[model samples]
Target: MKIRKIAFLITFLFLWRGVMAQENSSSLAFSAYTDVYYSYFSNEMEPNALQPFTTVSPRSERFGLNVAQIGLAYDSQFVRANLILHWGDIAKATWSEEYNNVQEANLGFKLANGWWIDAGFFATHIGTESFLPKNDFLSSTAVATYNEPFYQAGAKLTYEGSDDFYTEFWVLNGYNRFLDNNNAKSIGVLFSYNFSENTSLTYTNLLGTESAEGSAVKQYRIYQNLYLNTVLTERLILIVGGDVGTQSNSKLPNMEETAIMYNALTTLRYLFTDKWSVTGRAEVFNDRHGFISGLIPTQNSGMQGLELWGLTLGIEYKPDPNSYIRGEARFLDLDDNAALFSGSYSRHKRWELMVTMGYQLDRVFGF
Candidate 1:
């Protein structure tokens, strides 16, 4: 059986590559990237300890590798495919154990009209922040980004009718589920509008279930994400993003109560010179029902949730267009310090510092 499966995979790859290579104007590219960092946290913990609401540069008091990835991309007039393989602490700490090394793999083709369909694993369509280090303003993620879905699997139907207005419809296995947890299927949608070259707004949402296959209580979850980007000045950029989600309370069928969570963040970046820039960010999270943040109830506060605010400041230097070195400082404050969110490493208020350097190289060729 193992031999047969390996043979089948090899054959499928050869066939797919042969078909794509036969295209009249096919383009292919290979990409490599790596991000390495060192961090320090106020709360002292063991080297193996995990940080709260952090993925990039997660470990403290040690040098770490966030990600190192190799990617391949192919595109023809009507066909496109992308595959990325990665490893490091980011994958082990935040991704699925079974397929953590596989960051993204998807195939897409155009339909009869201006519509297109893509199927496979993909980055979630919810947040402005991404897993890639160079794409984010700070070295770490905000509370909103930490709680949001990072990746998803299924299919997307996208409309390419206009450049100013964009939309996508999704049929997913479940919320952030790679292999499908239950029999239930999920759905999502995204809408983006560009007012000008420098200003845009995006809204995306998902409706799904988080219950087990045959659990007695069926809980339905709804998540909403929104962001706005604008170039406020010649050398300054501003981005605002937020998330809201709700799930059926544990009470379930008896009372139909719901648990809601919401968060917001904003970032501003100012370029001081051609190769240097500074960024500042402010963020807040509230999970009164402790639905998504994993805030468990305590004796003093029955069912009270986790509420916190944080601020970040970072400076970045670019030696060239393909690489960056950034240093950041962040501080977080909790409303009541009594509840902890991310396992045993949580603290009421904490300070952290992170420094990372990222580099990427891509080679493009045409048939």
Candidate 2:
């Protein structure tokens, strides 16, 4: 009861503030989205033992709330501020222990000559996939789950060289860390180019040193991402993405050896009508040194490498611009000796089906 009261109070305060800001001509905006789904796995794996990237529907045959998020933004000619709060499974995985439910909090200043600077927590500039379901063709891909940083706390400077080209540079605390875990900071840059209204490309890179809790060793990590989006025809679209990363000098026994991982994926979407669409995706991921695939080491078995290939087919129906229902079926093929999919036993293949419903409310309360 107490928790419910607190939640209600928070919601009320956010709405009240948004309304007052609008009335005062402060240029405030509010938006929210909710995603929920049900998923079933062919292997009947217990909920607690499901693999990573499956957190959205952790239970094998149950309904779940993936995420409920609210965002507030205030913008003026010279200054801007934004905040996002989230709840449910995505919040548990993406939010740090310190921040709890706060997904993003940032402030920005518009400088002269099309240059701008911003500081505080912000979404990562890398990856073709987004944390929000509405932005994705399917639920998610392994590359997005294992090889990307969800968020970063940092400052950045951006330049709009022209209408078609943009670039940004970042100085961050570290990957996904709200509080700096070590003395070393990460540096990254993003470059984007729009070829036309129908095509675009992006490239991103990050390099940093990370220290685990209670450990003195500093692990060096380097990561790169490339993404391309193109419209092939009036009804067809294509997306291509690739990622590569490496980590070295860990606390493991072989500090000299570097672990490497990479993935590539492509997706195609066809819109048959204004309210209906179909999508297909193919992907390959290689975790050679078990660094990003969450391999568990056993006394006798040691660490095992993982290679995965996946394909997905999905359909989406939009009742309106603000609501959608999607259904997807995914098939995963693993290496012969990989045991990550079927408990302690090795499995070469696994499959899952999922259905999701999502809604977005933008300024529904006149905010």
Candidate 3:
């Protein structure tokens, strides 16, 4: 009798465990990825030296870790949540002075008629390049660095309508501020239209006040972005993006004029084989008021507008679905008399070469 009772108890527990596992299978998931790279700059900077307007490869001529992220997500019929942890230079640049390493922490719930609302820190919807290098076309564009917002802490309401249209409305802290920089809040909206499986267009706009509390000057920033993606052939794709922005009450002391900046870029990507591809990009960025680039006028140079143009060519080789190797060469040309490119003296051109390796692990422990 004792042996039979023990057997029955063990069998009951095993069945219960199986039931629980089945129930959780559809509700939880895990994912992670790592990106490491070595980069060399032709400017002759030391390893680990600071490179202006560059984030992923800030330190030239060195091996560096770009980003490593781990994420866990939960989804159900009515509710969903995601938590992502980040490490390496991507985190440092994304957060800046903020100490938190959380890349995304959001909670959402489904509403009626294909609507959903989410609240928390989320990646910005304004840029074509993602914080993760693997998701980007080449390394990154200069426009992505100087002109785009990295992340926003906010709440958003999204609607997925018929006919391949989608929209989002957002309310949030000041631009790029994980924590509120001031009492003022920002507002933004995004619209996307998918013409077909091969083509799409998106527009994003944001208006916000970034001034500190009790400051004499009230600074406001208005930003706009437009992006287009098209597949010209089964193996060829193209992307074009542009940005226009202005900030009132420039931080350049006693300057009350609106500072205007604009950037535009186009990228072409072609796949030669299932595992090999090439990408090229051309970009132009202009900081008309010396406000956007934040390069203060030196006594010799005075306060002059700054203009930059860049060209990038990269090749990628994927060994498997989960890993890849990429090599890229970038050339940058600046306006004459702009010393921002080379620290020692004013130069018109610069070059960078980089190689990256990436791997991803998804659903490692769950269905």
Predicted structure with the largest TM-score when compared to the true one? 1
Clashes of each: 0, 0, 0
lDDT value for model 1: 0.85
Candidate 2 positional error at 216, Å: 5.0
TM-score to native of every candidate shown: 0.88, 0.85, 0.87
TM-score of 1: 0.88
For candidate 3, write residues 66-168 as lDDT tens digits.
Answer: 8888999988656889998888866665464673578889999889667899999888878766667777777655655544777789999999756789999
Question: Please, what are the lDDT tens digits per residue for candidate 2 over residues 11-37?
Answer: 999999988776555477899999998
Residue 280 shift from truth in candidate 1, angstroms:
0.5
How many pairs of residues in model 2 come into backbone collision? 0
Off by over 4 Å in 1: 1-23, 250-255, 296-304, 339-346
**Candidate numbers, best lDDT first, in rank order:** 1, 3, 2
On lDDT, the stronger of 2 and 3 is 3
In order, what lDDT does every prediction score? 0.85, 0.79, 0.80
Stretches of candidate 2 off by over 4 Å are: 1-26, 43-51, 213-216, 250-254, 297-300, 343-348, 364-367
